[model samples]
Target: MGPSRPERARREAVAKVRDQILASLLSGRYRPGEKAPSVRRMAALTGRSRRSVHEAYRQLAAEGLLEVRWGSGTFFAETHPLALAPETSAPPPALPAIPLELRRLAERLELGEAGLARLVAYWAGYARDHVELAVVECNGEQRGLMARELGETLGVRCREIDLAELGPAGARLRRVSAIVTSCCHRDEVAPFAEAAGRPLFTVSMDPGFLPPLLDALARGPLVMIVRDRAYGPVLSRFLETLRLPPEQIARLAVVEPDGLIGALAERDRPGALYVSPLVRDRVGRLDLDGWRELEPRRFVARDEVDHLWAHLAWLRARAQP
Candidate 1:
């Protein structure tokens, strides 16, 4: 007696599903112990019958791609052996350009122009071979523009992420080379900063907090986009106390209404240190900086944000393992 047509089709479908399950597991599509899709969901996605999906899953369990946890649903096996392909010889393409709106917003906010420009130049000089960009945004309009510009300019993958949907230490955050935070909530930014050991680029309308923030970032390279000229003097004084060499100070550029330029020496460097005018004006009196006077020129501003992005890209490319 020959096997029925439906039985033969079911067998073939099971084989196909088994192969897919094995491939997905090997590629880390589903982490160990993570639930495999339900039979109905798998059927819907794969366009196969539910019964066939169930049978395929059973076959995969038998072959060790999955484990059936009795009352629990099926899961990718914890100890499944992964077969990795050989490393590709060819390198990835450059990152894309900034979108018009983001370019405008970043220009408007004056975020990290010097650092980002330095980053791009650095990447071109050093790696020139492999550089990827990941832009994080909560809004779709901005996200789409960034992704498109970056993809077109750099030829690298650009992804958008909704901050509201992201959890602490989410998988998407771990996959990026660097993070560009745009209008993200303060609370959300804090946690991502903690987890993002990589370079972070931020733009802000408020320049008052920048000095101390950059001070804290002295341990790492921090790029701040300053939109207001009023705060430049205060930032200049803060840098003067650091006493960095003229060459090092040159790296700091001001992004003003005009063009990007290095830190100015005209600002007064009083021996006595005081809190920033903005801080002082707001709080009346709070000693954020210690009484000790540090040299000025620590905070440099650039007129363009692209310069900042280039700088950061350079730093990140060089830092790569």
Candidate 2:
């Protein structure tokens, strides 16, 4: 009457892979008629198996979202049904690129061409220094991705540190010029920053997190797996800002990483399973059968990054010899 466990697992793996590609498509990362990455490339990128990725691509082809060529790689459909309509109240365009902003500031300071070049070089060197900024997160994968994205956005080489490992990072922690983290993690991270005597800045959680949140609620009861007890309250506070109804809130459960496998076993039909950044690695290691591990993409918000840029500029001004 029901699908076998392995069959269900295959379906779930395919669905999760499909969602990843769909997100990239919706975000305009892959434009119409653009060549999509090959199965091998995608498997490597997502750290998923080749079979899962191939199944996902085949499913998308059936849905008219992708075109697969025998010799050539897969390509995004020229006219897909999932075309996103422009938003009427879309947010304002981001502030000019960081380099452009720096150039403008140089002009305002009345620097000549040579002086401007020197200023640019100085800032570039400082930003590219690996010890300049430390990015903290509970999950290793999320931490690395977040740090890499922020570093690219700000032209900085960030030091990635796990929240749990902060205690052991004595000299490395002290060497960094500043520390940054998701606003949702500020509480847990603040104590570390305070102890290290380092200034802390928080970037707002990316809006991309909303899609997965809504999808999880619509599915049924939801269970969130987090790394430690500290994240429970912190995540709760962040969720409050979203204004979820009390009924929907009641449908959610926050469990520690250790409890995840046991919790799943207890439920005959588990609803949407969400993993916080801290526990992502743990979830990946578990044999979830068909259960999908939904985690939001780690992205740096432009406005927050601009605020970070301002702070870095001020520090540079004060540090001038």
Candidate 3:
């Protein structure tokens, strides 16, 4: 009784497009009073449908972040809204904006108000039967972080598993109510997602990913000080997002500053040494006078996590058992 597969997929797509637009605005790519790019241009930039882009712009306009002018295109508003009217101050509408397809199906079935309410309750019960979420990730470190993030955000039980652990066409995946992952692993995890027939959602980097990471990268070539060797691959992936090649970014596996200093003493590499929080704290205590340690320890963005939370809320509210 949960949302049909196509219904869920479309909503996810729209939500992602909307989030991407918000990310651009929050990242300062489109400033206040600036003419936002055309809907077609945004669709191409984000690799989403033009309809989705227009829908996102419409949503933003309603929220006062954007203004849509006929023939003039959309523009970022001069003043952003600080807060929306409280829910208690407004009367609830009799019907929410259900999808057209869903509405047609309901009409064909001739479902009355009471019948439709029962139908929703039945789906909610169906969703409740499988409450555990499976977070598909490429590496252990990424998986652990994804699980913790989603668990805290969604207030649901979440466990980390690699694509291999998902087991194509198996019982293990069937128990999961949803599948969530980092934006990077979406392709690798898609097949298993189909095999499991569960909803899949991707989390993105927050607007915060730019300033700290970009500022640090501008000062590269950086030597990464990994907290654990297992985190090397994920960190390496993040580094590749920079303009430089992989070889320019080096790593020192030890979690201590003295080890970093000793390693550096033996090498003649250029640029700064970027330490993870675990190592950064310890580095502050040591006197490695020549080494420049960058302070962008954690790179996850607020809006990035917001997308994953929005996906979870969709499942609970619209795809509920």
lDDT of each: 0.46, 0.65, 0.56
Q: Which whole-number lDDT from 0 to 100 does residue 204 have in model 2?
A: 69
Pairs of residues clashing in candidate 3: 123-320, 123-321, 124-320, 124-321, 125-321, 126-321, 127-321, 206-301
Residue 251, candidate 3: C-alpha displacement in angstroms: 7.4
Runs with alpha carbons beyond 4 Å of true place in candidate 1: 1-129, 151-156, 184-187, 203-305, 319-321
Per-residue lDDT of candidate 3, residues 85-163 (tens digit): 2222322212232223323433555654433343333223322333568877666555665665555444457767766
RMSD of each: 20.3, 22.5, 17.3
TM-score, per-candidate, Cα-based: 0.28, 0.44, 0.46
lDDT of 1 by residue, 246-290 (tens): 443433433332222132232222112323222233323323232
Cα distance off (Å), candidate 3, residue 20 = 30
Cα shift from native, residue 66, model 3 (Å): 43
Rank by TM-score, descending? 3, 2, 1
Candidate 3 has a TM-score of: 0.46
**Cα displacement (Å) at residue 174, model 3:** 2.2
Worst lDDT 10-window in candidate 3:
81-90
Q: Model 1, 285: alpha-carbon shift in Å?
A: 59
